[model samples]
Every structure is written in structure tokens, then in C-alpha cells.
Target: MQVSNRIAIAWPLATTAMHERVDALRQGGEDVIDLSIAISHFPAPLPVRQAVAAALREPRLPYTAVGGAPELRAALAAKLRGENGIAATPAHVIATNGAKQAVYEALYVMTDPGERVIVLRPHWPAYAATARLLGLETVLVDQPDVIDAAFLATLPAARVLVVNNPHNPTGKVLTAGELAAVRDWLRATGTACLVDESYEKLVFDAVHLSLAACPDWEALGIVTVFSASQSHAMMGWRAGFAVAPQAWVSAMSTLQGPITAAVPALTQVAAAAAFGIGAVSELLADYRVRRDMVVALFAPVAWAAVAAPAAGPYLWCDIRALTFDTQGFAELLLQRYRVALMPGEALGCPGFIRIGFIADDEATLRRGVGAIITLGDSMARAAGGHACSA
Candidate 1:
């Protein structure tokens, strides 16, 4: 048997691979603390649960249009209008299994093979992975602290640009001004934009502004994707949708027909309920406390520097002072201390690590952080360096 060239060239997403390793260790009776990716400890919002329950009581769940049930898409369009400021109609909405699928399909329909796609570094692995799967040339640039006209001018021309608001790992939310810069850049470059706002509702300090919120959004050719996974703690539900120009939605729907017809009927129900319910205040409070605790714990550690992120569940730690080989450090930490984390190399950055502080309880979270500090201190001492303050 022979595998296709595309399959042979690609590797499993590093974040998922680490999570599977943790799952395997636990299954083998080895205790492991997983911080590779954020998985909320909370359950799906009650409204979402009730909506699915209501759907279950129906006589028979029939398939809807490939895009979504007309009503569901209408509701999602209203969400885009009221919540996101995007002027959308049912014709512009397409329900997807999750944000990942929406991203894959958007890139597929928007760009051809060998076309350039610009992705900011320290991004979600799926952005680069999906581009590779479709055989697009990915041009990676370092994510600037602030996105402005000057920074935008430095990027190479590309067919599409992928933007993650309230970004992964670091949780840096793009401000309204930053979003304006992006919109202006997109207009000037005539480059299509794919904005992933999956973490919009996870915000803590700053507000999330959608790049497609402007009046010229359709003219700009922007596709904004949303997911229930992070916002409503509905990871396993795999409910998400994309808001695009009507033609783009039709193209994505055509591609989706042969792949996965429509999102499961129940998932569309959950999504309608999930996005309607605003921020999960209780869950946000819990995550805020955890985020602060992790930042405070790392404050005294000389070898690591972590800031309180504006949004999202992961903490990005800079460990370049200790070593640049974060991959090796992460591997040895998992082997020696039984703690799992994402090495920055996987996210297009080195000498850093991303810790997800949302999954485990406080005690377990503390223990995991302690183990990491202990290992780093040991490594520093062995290298004849000063001990970590922690």
C-alpha cells in the first residue's frame, strides 16, 4: 500500500500528539498532569444542554440543507449582526462541525495549491497544518506586539491571511485599533482574510473586535469563524459556524456536502443556544483566578517569565534564559516529573512553553507548576547557573 504525497509529508499536530501521550500514560496507570491544550473543566452551558434535549424529543431528526437548517442559519446570522457587528443573512452562514473544519474549508475554497498564505507565528497548529494539507505555501511572520500600518507593510503578499483574535498560548486580544489596521491592510492589499474568533467570549481584560465587523466586510472578502468549544465549554459537541460572503458560503457548502453534509442536527441546536447565551460569568471567574494564580507562581521564578493574558486559558512562558531547546526541556519534564506541556517550537517559536491552566483543579495545577519549577532548577544547577528563585 502507498500513501499519497500529502499524507506522507505531513505530521500529526504537536498539541494533539502531546495530549494523546498524556491520555496513554493515564491509561497505563501512570499519573500525568496535562497542560498541552486548554480543555475547560466546566460543562456546556445549561441552555445548550436543554436545547439538545429538546431536539432529542422530536419524532425524527431529519437532515437539513448542507449549510444548515434555515432557522439555525438565520439565528447565526442574527448573532453576526447583533453580537459581532457583521451584516449577515442566512445565505451567508454555514454551520460546521467545529472551527477547525471551517478553517480548513475556508482556506481550501479561497486559495489554490502553491498560493501564498500568511500566518502569524506562535499560532494555533491547525493554521499551518491545514495550509500544508492543502499544499499552500505558508509564509510565517512573527506576531507583533501591536499591529499597525508599519507592521503590515512588512508582510509579503499572499492570497490569504489567517488571524486569531484573543490568540492562543499568549491570549493577546487585538484591540479595535489593531483590527482597523488589519481591515485597512486587507483593503489595500486585496488579500482575503480568515479571522478565527473562537476565543471571543473568553476575554478577561480587553474587548475582542471582529475584523469583519465593518460595512465593507463582504467587499473585503473576510470569513470569520466561531466555535462553542472554548466559549461554552462544548469541546466534544464540535459545534461551530462561519460567516462569509454569500458566494463563499455557497462554495464552502458545496465542499462541505461531499465531506460532512451538515453539522449534526443536535449540534446546530446546541450552537444556536450556546452563541445566544452571552458570556459564561461563573466559568470566567474561575478561569481568571486560575490565570492569576499561575502568573503569581511564576513571578518569583527567575528562569521563567509569564504575564497575565488578556483572554483565553493558556499561559505562555518565556524560558529562553534557561535554555532554547524547549522541546527537549518539555520531553525531559514529562519523563521526569510526569507533567505535560506544549513546547513553543510546535507553535513556530522556540525557548518558550505554553501551559494550559484551565483543566485541572487548583491542587493539581499547583503541583504541576511546582514540578516544572523543580525540574528547571535542577537543570540550571547542573549547568552551573544560579538556582531558580521559586
Candidate 2:
């Protein structure tokens, strides 16, 4: 017997390798600064902590309803309705281990083996990888400098579209007009969308748009998935929920029952608490400051080009001037400077890198950015002289 062909598919390796290298360096007491994964350094809200502790002492630690505890689901539904302008009820929500699970489940329910799913570029690798895992082909559309009829024409044939708003890697928050265009396309094409709003509360520019909030979303088939992990700094808690039409939610609930049974009783309680008070404005302010700091720090890196992100906590840097592809650049940067940032190849784009600003404190950010800038200089000199490798 051999491993399943499905399991054998090649996933992104550069980012994972960088992570492992960072871990090894940390274990060896090296002063490595990690900017790869989008982990938050901010503290979780006080109420959430208290709730988790209280949940531990509750009498019944048994499995909960597959969707979630009714109170938690209802709380999330209320949050969605009020904040996202989506008309949702408890019956339309399905809680999962995290948005990661919710997204996978939605794709599983919607996709067939050889059908195509559309994904936007400079995206989270999981969106494409998961589609491939289910044997669904991924049709990638690079974020156009301008959306046009020609570009929009490329979308309709795909069975499902995966959208990450306040988009990952690039941190681009979609405008109202852009969201409207996508909504119109989906409605016209009869395509379904899996909307990942993981960073909804972290928007620093333009408002976040929820396709689920579109007036005719149920008619267009939208599945909006969200996580408490990013907003509340509850990464380890793995609490998330999805809002969709009642029938789709019901199917997800049933499909989810046997997978993990249900999200833990304790996690659900804590997440419910998190949703009750909401993402802290103080944390959002801090992240925005760091985002600005990172952009400012990279301003002098002559060999790198980056745009200030409009939302989320990343600076997407284009390093094509460095004379190496992203995989090589990431490996070399980690080895030479002890700086760990994600290669854009992991997100389906080469010659770019995503630097997450939220994980590092101000001092760490300064040092890491300085290292990258210095490395850029070295790379520039090498480009004019000789080939370089790490």
C-alpha cells in the first residue's frame, strides 16, 4: 500500500521550511526575528480569558451541538447581523474548529473532483491548496490593476470562488464598488463564493465588505467564514463560525458532526465571550501603527519595492531586483540575516514576499527591517557582480 495520491500533492514548502528553520534557530538560542506566519502578539481580551477559565469548571464537558452551543451561535449571528450587515440567525450559523475548517467544509460540500474554483492572487496558500486537496482545479486571477469587462469575463465558468477580504498577504481591503462588481458577477453566473473575513476587524483603510451582506446574497449563494483567532488574538483557541443560507449551514453542520464532532465546549464559551465584547480598538490602533512603521522602514530598501497595505498587518514587498526567485531569496535571507519572512511563492506569486507586521514589537521590527534593508544592499551589489546563494 502506498500513500493516497491526493495526500501526495505538493503544497507550498518555502514558508514551512522557513518556519522550521526559525524554530531550529530559536531552539539553538539564535536571535531570529520571525515575520513569516500571521500570528498576533497582542493580548486576548480579558473577558475571553475569564470565560475560558469558567468553562473549564463547568459540570458538562461533553460534546456540544455540531454547529456550536446555541448561545455562542446566536451571539455570532447577532455580531454578523449588526457589524457585517448580514441578515443571519442562529440557524444559519455553523461553528467549526476555526475558519480554516469552515472553509474546507464549505469547499468540500460545494466542489466536485475535477471542477474549477476561482482564487485571487497574492492570496493565502490554503485557499488553493485545499481546493487541490479535494481534487478541484484552481483558476487563479491576479488582482488586476483595474477590474474590467475582459477580466470579469474570465470568472463565470468556475463553480466556486474563494475570496479573502482585507485580503491576506497583500492586506488589500476591497472597496464597496469592487465588492459590488464581484456580487454582480456571482449573481449573474450562478457561482458560489467562500468569503474569508479573518481580518475583518483589522481594517486600516476602506471599509470591509461582506458578500453575505449583499441584499441578494442568498439568491447568489455566499458562504461567509470568520475566525475569532485573528481579531481576539485567540490563535490557539481555534474558534470560528460560518454564515450561509440555512440549507447550506444545515449541511455543513451534519458534515461537521463526524469530523471533529464539535468545537470544544470551552473554546465555544471563550469565543462567545470574545464576540460579545468584540475586537479591541486599542489592538487595532497598535496594529495600524506597526503597519505604518513597517512601511516606513522599507522606504529606503533600494532593492525592494512595497506598497503600504490598506488593511491587515502585512507589507507585501516585491524583491525582483534581488536577482533571485522568492524561494531562494527567503532561504538566503533566513540563513544570512536570521530574518524569517514568507516568500510570495507560497501565495502563488513569485518575486515577492509578505512581511507580517503584527508579530513583532517595535524594537524587533526596527532590527528586522534594518536587517532586510542591509541584505537588500548586499543583494544589489551581488546582482552587479556575481551569482549568490545561501
User: Pick by TM-score: which candidate is best?
Assistant: 1
Per-residue accuracy of model 1 over 173-198 as CA lDDT, tens digit each: 99889999999999999999999999
**Reference-based lDDT, residue 98, model 1:** 96
Tens-digit per-residue lDDT, 220-246, candidate 2: 889998888888888889988889888
* Index of the highest-lDDT prediction: 1
Candidate 2 has an lDDT of: 0.82
**Cα distance off (Å), candidate 2, residue 326:** 1.5
Q: Estimate each model's TM-score.
A: 0.99, 0.94
**Model 1 lDDT at residue 180:** 92
Cα deviation in Å at residue 388, candidate 1? 2.9
User: Which portions of model 1 show Cα errors greater than 4 Å?
Assistant: none
lDDT of each: 0.93, 0.82
